[model samples]
Target: MPAGGAAAGLVAGAATFVLMPFERVMPPLADGLPDRALWPSVILVAVLAATVFVAVWRTGEPAQGFVALLCAGAVGCAVIAALGDAAWLLFPDRMPDIVPLNAGPPPVRHALSRMEAQDAYVAAIVWGGLLVAVLAAVIRPVTRRRTAALRTLTFAFAALTSVAAAAGGKSEAVLAALAAIVCGMLTPATAARAGLPDRPASTAAGD
Candidate 1:
């Protein structure tokens, strides 16, 4: 049996300090929902973040796994944002909006100005970390039943994002989502291995 429930403070503290810029890219609720709706989302995100922390701690080398997943998530976000930049160049009208879609065709989305691109880069880092913190938490590698259930959860999230991105006509986001999928599937195992001391006789295992 494994001791659990202790990582909540650690994860919450990390999310607070390290994820400060996350609010900038988040969807505004004022258009439809009341401002109070934000609290539920905030609470949900905290629970999800805690779930992810526990999952990673279980599936990988404890401290190292969590850090590795964080690093991998950051890199994945960077790559996705870079891909988004490329997509912006190719299709000036198709850049993503984190908001819900309206009923009609949207107005033209312009190419990123130099200053806007800088802000986008910062947002990317935050979104990447936040996304992995919650969404990728579903993965519990090494155990078949848990892995399948979690993989299903991860893929469901991936599907929702993919559909949303496609609906928004953000092909770059759709492509970037593939990186997220990879992160969910592999980061724990990769990080766990990196943390382990090599031995000739036995393979390092996870659950």
Candidate 2:
């Protein structure tokens, strides 16, 4: 549990730190309309936090599932930021105000649209979707099933990578990469836990 706690703290702290840069990229609030442009990213982080708690509480393998999800989310943000513009036309009005659809030169409009899409991807789908799956994985714990944890992380990365590529750079590749790192840390912990000796309460206490 202590190891799981450490993993959770590390991933959450890292995610919060990473999200700080977003303040500069966010859209301005208008008449307190809630700034729909920023809601996705916010939702992503919130979901991640919830997923971390769920993963640790259930599988006792916080390092693998929760941390991997965090890494995937970061990669997702980067991918979306870099490649999202290529497919911006598909979701024309998904995020207003940030797209610059009617307020900029052709290249500038395209760039803004991409930037906005990337931001949304990072905040909403990449982070949000992964977090949701992580929670599902947590709910389905595998105390001695290392493969289940690995499979969860693998599926998340694969799905996000595919989505990012489909969106043509507005993807969550950065988040996916980060998730791989977390998965690496988690896998070993899962394997170790599977081999841990189970002792009776009295015997362990006497030792």
Candidate 3:
């Protein structure tokens, strides 16, 4: 991996760990929804999404591919998190449990409180995903291969596992901590990838 990529990942990971414990401080996301027990994952995804988009749009460097990976992963996670909303409306009686997979207290944390209040989940997903995807595709192709992609998946998976583990142990703090970690890992990779500079190969005659 390039020095920049490693540096970006380390920066992101450290930041995420620091921000994890603050989940409880955030407001609730949904009122009528069940399984509204906690807010860790919500904050993590939201932060990553915003940071990724900002980096890609603002940076003039050649890190578009990495930025695209980060932004896309964030959008994908958001969609997965809210999928239950659609399931609930489609089959009220059979609404798949929105409980964290590991089984924890009903969530009090609303990750999308601000957006959910003004728009339906469907609209949120539609707009967010569309915008992110369009931007990623429009950017130049990412040539760094699987490092960025795999790291992204690893961070998300770890964060999700934390949520489940916390739920199993009935520890809300754990969930928040993991969420922050995930966000940290994601933000810099996106930003760095979006802002990385390209160096031209030196010619033997020093053209």
Candidate 4:
């Protein structure tokens, strides 16, 4: 919930400056200024859990609801990594202090590695989340691209966090990259019901 909310906040916050000059209006968030705990990331975790909790009570089928909630959690996790971790990895230089989301000006990217890292993050979310969507069956699924967009955001959030954690944000990029890649593995995986519908065995990874 907050992951989606934050991404929308990040993008929308940044855009506000465009529609109305920064001097005339409020400011936008930088890479990871607030910390989030991911700085709202912790809050986001709660929101994500709530989505599942709602499903547990709201859905018609227990199995369907549990399965959907699990997918929602994965989407939330991917968003966390994509936003928080990716921010610190890319920005490396921006470690603005915690301010309101729109407290300061929208941030500008300054990292030398921003382009490559940005591309990788985009690819992972686009391809990774889409694959999950293609395969996943949930009671209520988020738009395919929306989940991917959330997953990709972890990097931008991570970059800001990196500057905070590392002070200088150099080697932190390396760790962020590695972590993002690994987290990519969790990019909203799909789960089939426990039993194969036909019990037909073919070549599968665990098989």
- Writing each residue's lDDT as its tens digit, candidate 1 over 1-75 gives 011222332343333323333223534332344554465457536654665566576665454345444544544
**Global Cα lDDT for candidate 4:** 0.38
Displacement of the residue 102 alpha carbon in candidate 1, Å: 29
TM-score of 1: 0.31
Residue 117 alpha-carbon offset, candidate 4, angstroms = 1.9
Pick by TM-score: 1 or 4, better one: 1
lDDT value for model 2: 0.48
Candidate lDDT values, in order: 0.44, 0.48, 0.38, 0.38
Better of 1 and 3 by TM-score: 1
lDDT of 1 at 158: 56
Instruction: Identify the leading candidate in terms of lDDT.
Output: 2
Per-residue lDDT of candidate 2, residues 66-87 (tens digit): 5545444533443444333433
TM-score of each: 0.31, 0.31, 0.27, 0.31
lDDT of 3 by residue, 124-203 (tens): 33333333333333444334433235344444544454444445432232333334334434433343244355223332
Pairs that collide, model 1: none
lDDT string, candidate 4, 1-207, tens digits: 222322333333232222321111223342325541243444445544555455456544555444444344334334533563356666556533333445435452323234324433333233323323322333233334433443554444344434534464434543454344333333333222233242223322332
Model 2 residue 81 lDDT score: 41
Instruction: Estimate the Cα RMSD of every predicted model relative to the unseen true structure.
Output: 12.3, 11.2, 14.4, 13.3
